[model samples]
Target: MTMLRTMGADRFNYNVFKKKMSKEPLYPTQECSYKMRIEMLDSYLTNQKTVDVSSYFKPGHLVIVDLRDPSTNASLVIALFKIIVGLFVKQRMETGKVLLLDKAHKYLNSDPCSARFTVSMTSLIRQQQHFGIRTIIPTQEPAVVPDAILDLVFFLVLHCFNFPTWMRNLRRHISVNQDRGESEGG
Candidate 1:
């Protein structure tokens, strides 16, 4: 409202300076390629009671960003997850921090958005030790897991993985048994 209603008058009551100055704009909205996409983020820019992230991300609070809607886009989830993870790392207590991604196979696929998200997650995984962070990703489909993430993962807590072909694909990314399908984490 202030940006649209900005008015400056002189001592003589003359409203002369009223041009939208590009050199010194009233509002500081930046000029970027993804400006439209950035503005589209509801959690980042909203005035209603819908923005509940800031208050929940406090110490000793288990903030769970669960978008259970099956129709939700992967890119949107990736963006929100990235933002939340970044904030969580910055404000985490000295004790440590944990980032759990349940059913990550949905977004850890071969799509462009998924690839970019995989890169971001792989970077986070590499710096986990330095930032006192631990990431736990539980996926029902191991085939969808990216190679970048598989190479960096320290452990794989598989439950009832009784298929031989599953181990064959799993062995391609990380070391595991060939015949009996055993995953001995490196």
Candidate 2:
């Protein structure tokens, strides 16, 4: 049995050696290419669960927040924001650079004030900025965010605004116009 196994191994090795020596490539050959066809399986599979937000924020990493849609459950959103802010604060304490927050106003809305999560998240944003951590907030509705928070933004990206009030407020920080001539004039 050992001798037979040795012979089989030797034969396999010789076949591989001969194939390498041949002009044809080892993979995707004319004779064996049909066997390499990948079939798409028609089977039901469970949807992938959403990732925990905590794992996303590393020390000294820049983050972009897109909270365009209002949250169904405000409490969960607030709790998540608190955890992120805490992580950023800890990271900043250890390292001088801060974790930046982008598009913060959507999650930190001020109107109605019924959403405890939005209020808490807004407070956290303010606190993080107070500790000398940089935060950049981009929003279409600047009025929804507090003036104190808006004042801290070092950089501003003003896209074309449809509302006059938004246009007026944006003009104070950055230039906004329909045409090149108007932009230069403003």
Candidate 3:
């Protein structure tokens, strides 16, 4: 027993272990969640790696929602999103690392289960600023995003203003509410 203890004694350095497991700020400052657009100039370049952007993300660090496979169903994505969001919120409240969800529309959709989760975003709005739960969703067609998620967004970053007529009308309503200093439906 003494020999075994001596052999194992060198492996357990509390200080080093603590530092490795410390729940400190893991991601870079100011680069929270975002939706990025990748434009491939040529058809051959579609599968090529344009840039290595992995440094921005930490390993075992970000919860990724991969719905690229055709077999991946909406129900599964909805369930996963709900779980991931809860985890992200808990981590944000405990630590300070905000999780990023790029192209959230891919994961969250208008399915029945997804709609149920969307309704839960009301509570999320209340704790957004407190827990630093920031989400950046970019879509060419904004109609794909659920209206519940839109209500919680305080800032809007539109790269192009050439919106469809329906979207323009929606923007008009949003602008009116903003001008009156109203929190959407709140």
Candidate 4:
């Protein structure tokens, strides 16, 4: 038997694999697994300088971006998220489900480097819905979030909030919905 190994091959070599394991059948007879695809992109992007992870979402697969790592730069993650959202818009891939935005207020601050592409969460929420992408934004206070976004979100799940201002602001946008629930945190 002859074996051929190529280091860091970009494209797939089905023939080589077939020759090596002639008795074994391919696992994915229909479509490639979504988890495998996410893993592949995660490995590929972590090594690149400027990661454009938007391409992965073109298929509308469920993806979770963990930004809780202290070493990870929040801004870069936000920029990457913007790229994904932009791709979602460009490709018209709308799943019509809440995207579940965490720490969205971080994008409110000004950052000159990503200014051009740093879109508002409000706009993203509005635009995403057109393509059937709903968003769940958890904010400490309505002050941190713009009135526009507050107005745009179809549902609001309120939790224990301290300040009266947050309640005041929320009242303007709050509408009666059975989906609304409480959270342990604001």
Candidate 5:
């Protein structure tokens, strides 16, 4: 529907299209595109019921939604995490909420998902003090992680990092140049 203008298609003309297709046949590309969309919808949406995603989230316990599928879309994974984060922020808890994006470079990079997640996370990070939330994201490529996040970060943890090459690269990154000079000596 959003692409109707770009597609040069008239809106509210499904019946017109149907009548035309009845006389003619769909072109090869159109046939393949429709078939692929049907298959994709069936694969993801079949047998799925509308349910609360946050019911599994508890106050004092950590719940991990692990996606082991190699072919899963990064946007889908981030979208699920966004829902989880929103739910977590609303829950009353004794312990402070900590969000860990474990090896998040795989799913949070300079892709279509990156821009939207960056905006959402930037807002969340800016309000972390009020919300008592801490976000820890470990990525080998800090470039993949949005600059807004890196700017708001107060602590940077580098574990077992002994490569001068990486250290040199990190020096150019946000805050590593100031106090981590001895790290590359190892």
Candidate 6:
């Protein structure tokens, strides 16, 4: 009879070797190594080729909602408004790179009822613009936001000049097209 000896088994030696190798660092411990990895990820995203939004969304698949109601709950109102605007911005960023906000005066004006809501909304819009997001705000109320902020708007719709002074102020930044042909050409 032969005595069983496990001490020199090849399986045991293999396991011991793996355990030793696992304890050794596979990567450098320097902070710069970690930073370089993050930078690579960011560069990948920035350099990604642009794709058509139609590939992701079907034609005529857009939803628009009005959040001008004063009776709606503040939190619910803000959340829904954010969802709509977020979708618009996402689509714009992916495809068009531009968005038009019609009747923006309603939000920019300082109404006694929706002052907080307007302030928060304006802040978000401004932040989005700062990040290379293009927004066209067509509003008759020139006093709502500072002139510098309004200057970012590339297009303006000047119609029915109920306020001549406001029209004049807007004219400084945007050209007024009284003729429909001129507006269409623009």
The top-ranked prediction according to lDDT is: 1
Q: In candidate 3, what are the lDDT values of residues 1-186, reduced to their tens digit?
A: 122233223433223332343443435431231111112212322354442122223434654555454544565555545544654554423335554556666545676766665665546765777766665667666766776677666777665645455354456436533443223221
The regions of model 2 sitting more than 4 angstroms off are 1-72, 92-103, 111-132, 170-186
Q: How far does residue 163 in candidate 5 sit from its true spot (Å)?
A: 3.2
Give the candidates in order of TM-score, highest first: 1, 5, 4, 3, 2, 6
Q: Quote the lDDT for 151 in model 3.
A: 66
Say which prediction, candidate 1 or candidate 5, comes out ahead on lDDT.
1
lDDT scores for all predictions?
0.64, 0.47, 0.49, 0.53, 0.62, 0.48
TM-score, cand. 5 vs. native: 0.61
Which of the numbered candidates is closest to the native, going by highest TM-score? 1
| 3 versus 5: better TM-score goes to | 5
Query: What is the per-residue lDDT of model 6 for residues 94-157, given as tens digits with 9 covering 90 to 100?
Result: 3334445666555454565346546545565567655445566666566565455556554555
lDDT of 2 at 150: 57
TM-score of 2: 0.44
* CA lDDT, candidate 3, residue 108: 53
Per-residue lDDT tens digits of candidate 4, residues 85-183? 555455544345447777766665456533432345666776775667677777775676755666776766666666655655666777533244433
lDDT by residue for model 5 (1-186), tens? 222222222222223433354465668886775566546545644444532344555767787767445544566566656655776666667768888878766765566666777788889989987888888888777656766676677888777676666565555545543654565372
Q: Model 2, 123: alpha-carbon shift in Å?
A: 5.7
Q: Give me the runs in candidate 5 sitting further than 4 Å from their true place.
A: 1-51, 172-186
TM-score of 1: 0.64
Residue 177 Cα positional deviation in candidate 4, in Å, after optimal superposition: 14
Judge candidate 4 at residue 7 and give its lDDT.
10
TM-score of each: 0.64, 0.44, 0.51, 0.52, 0.61, 0.41
Give candidate 5's error at residue 43 in angstroms. 18
What is the RMSD of candidate 3? 15.8
Estimate the lDDT of model 3: 0.49
Cα lDDT over the full model 5: 0.62
For model 2, how does the per-residue alpha-carbon lDDT over 51-147 read when each residue is reduced to its tens digit?
2333455565656543333423443444445555654554434444454445555556544532554555446556765665655556667766655
